[model samples]
Target: MPVMPSSAPSVEKGPTLRNDSFSDRRDSVNKLETGCLSIIVLGASGDLAKKKTFPALFNLYRQGFLQSSGVHIFGYARTKISDDELRARIRGYLVHGKGGPPHTHSEDVSKFLQLIKYVSGSYDAEDRFRLLDKEISKHEISKNIQEGSSQRLFYLALPPLVYPTVCKMIRRFCMNKYNHGGWTRIVVEKPFGKDLESAEKLSTQLGDLFDESQLYRIDHYLGKELVQNLLVLRFANRFFLPLWNRDNIDNIQIVFREDFGTEGRGGYFDEYGIIRDIFQNHLLQVLCLVAMEKPVSLRPEHIRDEKVKVLQSVLPIKSEEVVLGQYEGYRDDPTVPDSSNTPTFATVVLRIDNERWEGVPFILKAGKALNSRKAEIRVQFKDVPGDIFRCKRQGRNEFVIRLQPSEAMYMKLTVKQPGLEMSTILSELDLSYGQRYQGVTIPEAYERLILDTIRGDQQHFVRRDELKAAWEIFTPLLHRIDDGELKPLPYKPGSRGPVEADVLLSKAGYRQTHGYVWISPSL
Candidate 1:
């Protein structure tokens, strides 16, 4: 067990404030820099553990951000499988799933295989947990680190039901013994809980054993580089900051549209409908990153504070302003039963009552089985009221930040025609990732998130208050859906969505921010 260095800052007083006149703060001491650590992933045999989790870790390692020599990995799960079976199961997902890495390089694959070791046990049984703890301790001691000097991380890749059991077992047997000598950090996956109360209870239960800092709430959306660039795009650049308010901007739309229905996994999909499934965890987080007030500092808590404020500011959505859609299943897809309770699509007309966005609506329209797969943010600047260029065929100025297939920033404004004509036409000032940074492989979301956890940066992780705030914003709609008051509009398999979705936007005098139409000139 590696204890916090005596030189480590005192936690009772909180992080020290940094200043020019004062010496460096204590929090800055063990604060992880860009590249210096090894990560141990628990539950490395599960679906997420293999398809997303391992590939992400491997990408970071391949990119040279993770140290190849000192790093270690261990996979813990219930299924009693041999090492070859575990590797084969992981390989199936890696070579075949979306965003999975290639299965090349026998030498490199062997090296990574050497890092992985699996242990099997029933998660609910205490004796199994005791055995697992003993295994971890023996491995750490055998590494030849004096009497202590071991740091461990446990990632909960399991679902919400098993989380409490896992947490309690770790606390009672695994973490308590290592608390004083070494640090143990636990990273939890989201849909933190099904509702606000559940989220709070889980946090409280976890916090009983681990301090707030030790518990990292993962939201993989924040791992994308484009998502992180949002801060830089808004705050760092003075060009667009002035026009970001209600005065110049008409409305902001954050969309996460998908074209495919729930392919199998009906059990998980039906339990968590559209509201709890995507909007609460992913879409809301994106909205917060865009709408949050500038943090006082780059500290994790400080950044989370601003995000919470945005979530809190989001007004309770009325039943009329939102629309839910369910893509009915076909006879071919046997997984989706006729009586399935899951929603395949959803749209929320959210509002923030803060001064900067008092009247402007922030619409979040996301769904599966839509016309196309798109994820982007559109900021429609207020139309020029009495534009001098109106006679010259002008259009609204819009800024778009795209985060899929290609990561890029683009602005649509009317530019003068090049053929010696004075007529104004809309053209795009595009900064596509493909065009600008050639040959640079932008990492997948999971890869970046896994690396960040190893580095101990909580900026991308969700906070407890933020989680509650997100659930609060969606609770009313959830209630409406539960009480049979809210009905989903039926949309076709290949269409954009139901007609009600169009009405939801049209009533507000805005249109759905479709990419192709937003790009093409009006005939």
Candidate 2:
């Protein structure tokens, strides 16, 4: 374990690490004991592995969450780089231009680097299976020689296409060997597939190799402190629980818009578009957490069971209710040149058949090449009907939960302006996290998630059934677009989105909550 430098000043009373302050009390003597974790990151040379994964692990090490003496990391990839090369790659990414923590002088990093051993192998070849097997055996031998047991965490940082092959190889050479006295957990990345059919097939294939419990379906959003706070805010706060349903709430909206387009990753973006690329896993997962019922327990299975139910309850979208948009001409974008592909933007009005959210429209919109960058959820309450303030200009009360540019939550309620025309005015009761809590280190999404995986907590991870249920809700709309039954609306780059997006909400006899909508000012 690396001791943090004593010379570095410590912010002892910093802001809370997580959003929620209230939690169920566990008996001090009976709490579950977490063991030392050994993680093996596949595709260690990849961008995600270096930038996100390594930094996250380093944070964990600095926080003393990981055992310094017992921890081991193996970097497996096709590249024939030396151990020092791998450490340099990680170190460069950590110290990259973001002004992160200083690089400490300690043997911990060197020892960590010594544990990293690379093996050359094809991503999808059976002959490489032997090399993969040898790597695992070597790790086990090294661990036993140093300590005792050999528990392993395998993270697949490759693209979606290689997931199945990697799982099959793990089953043949890794899983069976680690079963008896040790445990094996695998982390899979997103964009599981292009659509429902492919997703199902991929899920089935993965299931054959690993049990559902051993699989950690990664979605970095859930790892965010604010994202995790969604659950605690509703469940832990007594005052908010009564108003968290259809009777008190009006409608919910989730927006995930990026100012820039694919940014040269267009070749990859063209295939999945905005729907599969972001909405399928990231946006929907947020919706589930916001709308899901309180589970019986905080156990992974219980939490996921409730989420699956929420997804299953979502009413399937018909053509009349759904919206699609594609950004015009991918000229400079090499991913889709002269592309007639569907919109880089889309919005859908979904209703759930469940008692809690029957009438409320769960509006979801995600796009690329939009005017501004934002990711937020706004819950709009129904207007106070036929009230004394019926003559007021403001519409309704709303609660906004922002996830990007900052992490915060606030509510918009109508208040009477002093010495006004006996009328009401709207103002915000804001809770800006950065301003409210000075000098808080909100861990990056991957940092929190990697720690969760190390601790064997799957509450933040997605479940197989939840994935299937999500696919079920979107499959119909997916087919409509794929079969040309639904034509995508055209919108210019650097704009909010297609006019059809506005129309989608208009048809519902509603509009997006102002300041909550995706409006980009001239940059």
Q: What are the per-residue Cα lDDT tens digits for candidate 2 across 74-186?
A: 77788888778888888766554233444652444554456566666777666776766676676556545323234568889888888888888777766525333346778
Estimate the TM-score for candidate 2: 0.87
Error of 2 at 76 (Å): 1.6
Worst 10 residues of 1 by lDDT: 12-21
For candidate 1, write residues 57-162 as lDDT tens digits. Answer: 6555544444334356667788889777887777655455443345554445556666666778877778877877776766665555433335567888888778
Look at candidate 1 and tell me the lDDT of residue 60.
57
lDDT of 2 at 495: 94
Please estimate how well model 1 matches the true structure, expressed as its whole-model Cα lDDT.
0.71
Off by over 4 Å in 2: 1-36, 97-115, 124-129, 132-136, 143-148, 176-181, 418-423, 512-523
Off by over 4 Å in 1: 1-42, 65-69, 92-104, 146-148, 176-181, 330-341, 391-394, 511-523
TM-score of each: 0.88, 0.87
